[model samples]
Target: MPEKFDIHQPDDRFFKSAMSDPEVVKAYLQHFYPKIAAIAYLSSLKLENSVSLRPSLKRFEADVIYRCRFQGEADGRFYFCLLFEHKSKPDKYVAVQVGLYIMELLSSMVKKQGRELEPVLPLIFYNGKEKWMPQTLSELFQEHPHFIALEPYIPNFRFLFQDATRLSPAALLELVGVLLLERTQPNFVLIEAR
Candidate 1:
């Protein structure tokens, strides 16, 4: 529970640290990512053990994971994995990195948890200075928009993207208690850990 608007290190690092709080994570998704919060059992949300997810290592940038179950499933045996990634910049190759990470996670899960494959939902949080338009995996591979024929051949999956740069102050008001989200300068956001 630090009490300072720290700006010494990178903002993305601070974001990752703030996300370590389950309350912050829940509030973030519940307010920012309602589509997922609607069907997900937020009460049962729990972070997975930390693991390296660097781009070179076939992982992602701050690949925070959470295990969740559907809200109202009769037999809550299956789990829906939420793969959270935060990017400090606009990365064109992010879809590729996320794809590889998903595959790696599923393979590891099958070995540990029987033959059932848990569904993974990739959620990317971009708090960069510039605006980033996130694209699907297939959209990145398709050089031209007319390449509809290749749609069936390549892997096409959509991800949940939250661009903090585009978020208004009102949208961020609820998260103030867990972590104070403030804009100290034109493009930089200062996060004060609670």
Candidate 2:
């Protein structure tokens, strides 16, 4: 395994490389969250195989969003927003970052076509050093004055995290080992090998 504090910035080439190898992505996600592997596979919609990690923004930035079409049952095209944030310790700022990304995605879409569009799902794949549990209304209210209670409206399918920091050492090793294995590529290999 590589060093723990790998603050090295992965370039566009790296992104393109992984995008080319759908197996790498599937393995990475499976390692990140084995419990939700099935759901992740379903939601993947065979997207990595069809699309590239083409960033819309000129400036290289965090929360890079990628667009892809679903080649699965429905064949619906969707945008997968990938937010990369690395931290030495756990914090509550993840919500703010994800919130900003979601806002940016909708705002950009509306601005492009000059019209309102339906909500797009934002699946955040977190490779950070913390476990992200979305802040609740009560928790947020605690920080502010109690004069008016803020009823937070958190929508479903808004955000999801691939929590690496929270997983046990054994689990983490198992996941990484799975990801590193060349033969155990994507779903087919997973099904057959398992």
Candidate 3:
């Protein structure tokens, strides 16, 4: 028999734990995806209590969902979901998959039939070998003359995508620039690079 090395590393558990904290998530938004972060009042961010349709997601406890109102407007609420997917290569149907998750979340949120649904922004952090720039719903289809008719009703919304493969050393510096971690995690050695 060949020798096998077994090392227990904090995979999903660490991810779920770290992402559960609003501050950590806030720091991530503030640091990398500032434009999306600006859309919300980050102070009012609260985690929503919702179950997932997938068993894998349930076992991993990877659902990091936050609900908050717009920066200035308090009447309506917005949700931004953080999904951490580590794929070796970019999947073409990633947008469809993300869309399904967002739709599932939306379905779970609706209590009444006539009530309006709050906007939910799906944020994908793609850490993989190849670069991925997420496409909007409209972009997924062939943009021929015949396709022009369907464009208006395509329900276009872009995913807040971050491709880790394309990140430079500067981006790492950018990531840790605003993150001053108080919690000690073996996985994170956040050094504030000027």
Candidate 4:
């Protein structure tokens, strides 16, 4: 028989522990994905009371599990599944990882809804050393010699908030704290690289 290696997944317990300190959570979320700060805040409202963390999956493990209503002031309901994966080190295979996450979320949704499959939009929060540069599959074909045309609608957004001089004492302290928190995990690595 083949051996099955032991695998671990972050649970609601981790989420609860991490979020026990509101300031820490707020700073982490704000620095990671500013656009989603409001949304994360809204979702965290019910986190302790209703949100289920690390919901069972068929295969891959999700880092953070959350459920929040995307309520429209007039429309009333827009339910979404916010799945988070915390990475301390860069994964060269991030695209594949994200793709898998989307697939899993869709499959779970299909079973939950008990209906035909529908396209789902997923938001991925990446917190790793290497900057996430998501490019279209077609972009891979750009060869050197000849000039490849540039599209007006290049869809790449880079988020860089890590400058030594710019970081306040408090921010630096918090950053170090997060690093220390994840030190026990194998994925932890020094992110002091330029």
Q: Highest lDDT among the candidates is held by which one?
A: 1
Ranking by TM-score: 1, 3, 2, 4
Give one digit per residue, the lDDT tens place, for model 3 in 84-118: 43334577777776676677767666855654577
**Residue range 49-150, candidate 1, lDDT tens digits:** 647554466533335888887888746566788888888789998888788778877877777745468898988888888989888888786786667877
Q: Candidates' TM-scores?
A: 0.76, 0.51, 0.68, 0.46
Model 2 Cα lDDT, one tens digit per residue, 1-194: 88787645453334444434445555655655454344443345243122222256434234334343332323342334343333334456555655555566565666765444434444444345445665533454465664244444433233554455677877777655544553344454323235
Residue 150's lDDT in candidate 2: 45
Give lDDT for model 1: 0.74
Tens digits of per-residue lDDT for model 4, 47-107: 3222222355234555444444443422223444444445444455444555566566566
Pairwise lDDT winner, candidates 2 and 3: 3
Better of 2 and 4 by TM-score: 2
| Runs in model 4 lying further than 4 Å from the true structure | 1-34, 39-58, 71-77, 114-170, 174-194
Please report, in order, the local distance difference test score of every candidate based on alpha carbons.
0.74, 0.45, 0.63, 0.46
For each candidate, C-alpha RMSD in Å? Answer: 7.3, 7.8, 5.3, 9.8
Which numbered prediction scores highest in TM-score against the true structure?
1
The predicted structure with the larger TM-score, 1 or 3, is 1
Candidate 1: the clashing residue pairs are 53-60
Winner of 2 and 4 under lDDT: 4
